[model samples]
Target: MTTAARYATFGVREAHGVSPAYERLALAVAQDDEVLALLEALPPAKRQPNLLFSVVRLLGGPVEEPAAFHDYVVANWPAIEPEMRTRWTQTNEPGRCAVLLPVLAALPQPLALLEVGASAGLCLYPDRYAYRYGEHLLGAGEPVLDCVATGVPLPDRRPEVVWRAGLDLNPLDVTDPADVAWLDALIWPEHTHRRARLRAAAAMVAADPPLLVRGDVVDDLPALAAQAPADATLVVFHSSVLYLVPEPRRDAFAELVRGLPGHWVANETPEVLGCDGLPEPPSEAQHNVLALDGKPLAWTRGHGQALSWFG
Candidate 1:
């Protein structure tokens, strides 16, 4: 798809209900040839709406109004282009832990988690946060996550995570203000709750940082997996991480993980994993396919707002 098509689809499928500001901005960007051309100059992967909008937000540019946003993006193209080139759209949403909780809790007694594309390793601390799975609350803490789930056995308790680590091309440090600021910017304009959740999650990780390694997911996975305790179930997992990777690389990573001991949990867009025969998603809104050991189990909202299990 062209950049314009991607932006239009994102506006409709992703931001329509979640973020009005983003929906308007994305639709406007899709129609603006000037802006589209500017985006076309960047690498294909860097042309993502999330990257552009986040960079603008990060640089204090306007995203609420289309005209102003366009002008600012063009005016600041020199600065924006460089940032987009260097940065990846690592939206480390801690809310996604809600979707993973059910599967993680069902795994063996203790788990050793290794996350791919773990920007700040916030998802690594699922045991640290609280969750509200539609009236069935689990744990007690700040930044409580809420998700509407159906046809799923809600976890009775959080998993006992004995070890946790993350692999990213550029692992973000939760303690760094700049890194945290980038994370904050990646969140949609209207998601104040998510911003608050980010702070809480960041602080939690900062208090005791995980072993976040700066390396390629495929090349560096085995070394990191080797570090996991043998006694624990080493569950290698990733959420919204594979789409950025080329198809071949994604397949290679999948193969490598399957060969390793323990389980594998992947929550990604159906197309990302070439998933076939998935039941119809619960709604028209964008939903990722949640699979365990390459078996599709549920359809999940991007930010873990809801889930529909059809295992």
Candidate 2:
């Protein structure tokens, strides 16, 4: 069957209680001649698949990023096999970890950051001016924040970040308006506010594009992690990017980071299990904020984006 068809079937079956308002995917694979042709193109391993497709099926609503990939499947089903296309669930929600805000407060001065899998880099440049923290406001019209967080002490004039960069398998170069527009369009329309924030950030980056690289995390992790300044609290962070990696590969990458010297904070899913037959799906998007010694400080998500305060 076509990849979309397979995923559609899986999603339809899972909708019972997984997501109340999930997308309703179709299972017209048998009827579509294109599906058979697509299935024929699959390697023996994928064609003999049991539940990989079933795990990521679509239901109830439109598949996220339909604009970037839907038509590609419809027009080229024979060329696109089930294994190549995956159903992705976009996660752009801010965190609710209590330790995070307090960590931000402890910065000694302005700072730098590096975000891996920074799809469009909006959250990477989180300090572009004003933000509301319940009744308190931070950054007061600053052109993005240069925050250098610590375990204690919320002070102004933190460390000066010599740089801020990001790495992604598919990096978004906002200097090109077309690319920026495409990234903006990729965002689901339901998230109007997020779309707006992404647009504003895109505009800011368009003027001064952030340093980005398109590469594999396995190969790029070491170099990127090593780039952190010694005096600076080097933070190698990512959001919702770990699910795409294999367990062994993910473990290897995390081990490499832990071995590095600096603050290694990775915001990944906490889900260490639940892939069923598929081996890549993570357990949960745990908000991992670690100290320079490679220690996890908290875990959470919400208004403050705090998960837990181990401190």
lDDT of 2 at 290: 33
Q: What is the C-alpha lDDT profile of model 1 across 1-311, one tens digit per residue?
A: 99999999999999999999999999999999999999998889999999999999999999899999999998999999999999999999999999999999999969999999999999998998999987899999887998999998998999999999999999999899999999999999999999999999898899999999999989999999999999999999999999999988988999999999999999999999788977788878899999999999999999988988998
Q: Which stretches of candidate 1 lie over 4 Å from their true place?
A: none
TM-scores, all models, native as reference? 0.99, 0.60
lDDT of 2 by residue, 68-151 (tens): 234445654443344244322223233222224455445543545677676556555544445443434465542322222323
Rate residue 60 of model 1 by lDDT.
Answer: 98
| lDDT of the candidates, in the order given | 0.94, 0.47
**Candidate 2, poorest ten consecutive residues by summed lDDT:** 273-282
- Whole-model alpha-carbon lDDT for candidate 1: 0.94
- Residue 309, candidate 1: C-alpha displacement in angstroms: 0.7
Error of 1 at 191 (Å): 0.4
Error of 2 at 163 (Å): 1.3
Deviation from native of the Cα of residue 122 in model 2, angstroms: 2.6
